[model samples]
Target: MSTPTGFMEYQRELPADRDPLERIKDWQEFHKHFSDEQLKTQGARCMDCGTPYCHTGIELAGSVSGCPVNNLIPEWNNLIYRGLWREALDRLHKTNNFPEFTGRVCPAPCEGSCTVGLIGDAVTIKTIEQAIIDRGFDEGWVVPQPPKVRTGKRVAVVGSGPAGMATAAQLNKAGHTVTVYERADRIGGLLTYGIPTMKLEKHVVQRRVDLMEAEGIEFVTNTEIGKDITANELVENFDAVVLCGGSTRARDVQMEGRDLNGVHMAMDYLNGTIKSYLDSNLEDGNYISAKDKNVIVIGGGDTGSDCVATALRHGCKSVTQFGTHAKAPLERDSINNPWPQFPNVYTLDYAHEEAKALFGEDPRAFSVLTKKFVGDGNGNLKELHTVQIERTVDETGRKIYSEIPGTEKVWPADLVFIAVGFEGPETPIIEQLGLAQDKRSNVKARYGKYVTSVDKVFAAGDMRRGQSLVVWAINEGREAAREVDKYLMGASMLP
Candidate 1:
């Protein structure tokens, strides 16, 4: 257990972030490093609650309340407080295969459910989690521990994102021959391109890929399952196959003028920038430049937030974001979204904070809807016709998006990005594999048992469960690996 009076003796202090004004000028990470002592102090804040709900990994009101990977939060925290870095890393790795990635990108529900959060600020769970893994890497404690003997059962994993990586890692550890296929030019499906470099630097992702490659995992990039390589070939060649293709079909806007030249989907724009930035920072002529242009991002979620930040860095003249629902409150609403569950509170993420500092105000305009895109005669986006919306709960307790009266507004836009979220996994792979799909178009796979309708095949991650956090993907991937192992060897010794 941690020190009894630790919570009272210390306050939660996170790593300091760079000034927004300066950070927006480049694509480097914003946060400065925190010393081991400071992180240890924060880790000690973990209370000795009889039930440390932080690691429960349970679903409440349709959202997760704790660590989805079921990380031994308190155990690691106590170890960190005692300066047992290796022990903490061991505990962390027991549950999650990729703490470094989650530590950076995960929107930590664990922190939201911390017991300390009830009275004061939550423990710096994310910071401590990152610190542990970072120290492990720096100390050269993290390295490939390949299986002593190979199971000789070949496994094909489709997609190289979090789910596929986790599945490959766990299965390979169980001594299975695993090969991951990625359609993109590089490995790491979304991690390589979907996410901005500023949010999660490319090198951090590549480091893990490099490590995985060294551990006997075969990674085939620029190879689509259904296109470059036939689905039938993969199914027949491998003893078992797992589909971890993440949801990539962008949810599109059906309004008029949406096909204009300056209008683009968030992922397309983000991926293009990633490809171009690495090559020549738009000198490659493949990236859509937002420089000196009025930019409008439709959506206020993480994807939209990323779009805003990317545009600002590209030197966009102005940035404005519109959400289809009411603006979130500045703090937690105890009545609707209580503690222990991931609170649906309106919190300013890094991008919003930077935008506020640079633009003199938050770039978000909530409860707003884009009625249509207005394009110039030559097929370039010119402006956005928008309206405000009112959110009300119906008698059935379902929230309804109703348009507010007389709130039509016109906003100039040189470039527009639609970040409404993903619909489901792309249809080509599903069609090629002849896999059944749920109502939401996600691949139909039973939870806990990741078996798809097809025999000797499995599915996990966003492809199985729709858009979710990286932790859930890790959880699903681990669970799927256990099932796969059982299928391959008729029993699984994996946790």
Candidate 2:
């Protein structure tokens, strides 16, 4: 409680983003910074409730309700309000190993469960969070602090994403030798490539990686387990193994003309664009180009939105995103989507904002299903055939989508990117390690205890829990490290 009436005294505010039209011309991050006074004002909006749900980190109604990393929200908020940014940064790092990444990419369930939001708007927790970490970096407060001592034990983390990075960081803190292996040419699996640069610049990721490296964590890139090196070899070489390889098999739309030249997976397009952009600033001409082409992105998730943004940067003539679900309400539906759960409300995300700025309308088309790809004479995608759908509940309370009559339509599409989400972890490593899998094909490791059927083997992150947010991945990674520490030593001190 910085002030008794602080929450009422201040209205919620966030830093304005760069103009969508102007930002679309370059790949730089679009978010601007707020002044210190503005950030302190935003920080004061925290209510600091007696029973604050902001840090509960629990799942409600099948979605996360609060901060998954169990961030000490109120403590940091008060510190910021008192003009103690150094203290605020320290408190923020107590739970989250990588606030910079989450601050930029996370959806901020913490805001949704804020006590202030129940009455009015939530505190700008995300904005303040980013500000704290950014200031920490600017002031040179963040630095590599390697473990003071070394244990005889060694641990190998498979994957260099958030989960794997967190696991390595914690285990190293416990005095164990840590080695992280990334199959990609670069470190930071999803963060390095899967995410677009406008949301999170690659340099930010590299900066953290450099610090981790300086802290004595060895990162091996361009090498994969179960392929370049045998999984058995990894199990034999390391005292303990933690699998954090994310669910990477992108789901495909099994429709007619699927093999057409212009039909591609969303990840493929995104990955290629990023790789080329980073490699030569897009001068290599190695990625799929949308210039002078009409693009249609299927599946309306973050990946789909990313595809839309990437297309816009490539100078696409037009773009449209397809979603099977109905458009969300302008506000939360109190009856079906009560407070404390993530609000299913409508707002223009960055990609949609950019699309609208250029195309004069939002690119998303809700409650639409793609029938098939219509190709040109030479096996190139020319157009997409789709129909409007209506949702209904069946006798057994199962939701079903039925096509509407006389609503069939075709739209020109020079390229089609499928962003329907992922299936599970690719089978090579799972099969090679002989790890048991859940019904969903994810690694069969319990949430809190990340033990696998194979002795001394563990799993976490999207590989264990299926596709999820970055915050959840960090949560699992930290928890898995604690369990691994307990297994290695008689007791564990990791929190």
TM-score of each: 0.98, 0.99
Q: Per-prediction RMSD in angstroms?
A: 1.1, 0.7
Q: What's the CA error at residue 211 for candidate 2, in Å?
A: 0.6
lDDT of 1 by residue, 123-213 (tens): 8998899889989999999998889999899999999999999999999999999999999888887888788988788888899988988
Which residue pairs clash within candidate 2? none
Candidate 2 deviant stretches above 4 angstroms: none
Candidate 1, which ten residues in sequence have the lowest lDDT sum? 323-332
lDDT of each: 0.90, 0.94
Candidate 1, residue 112: lDDT: 90
Candidate 1 backbone collisions, by pair = none
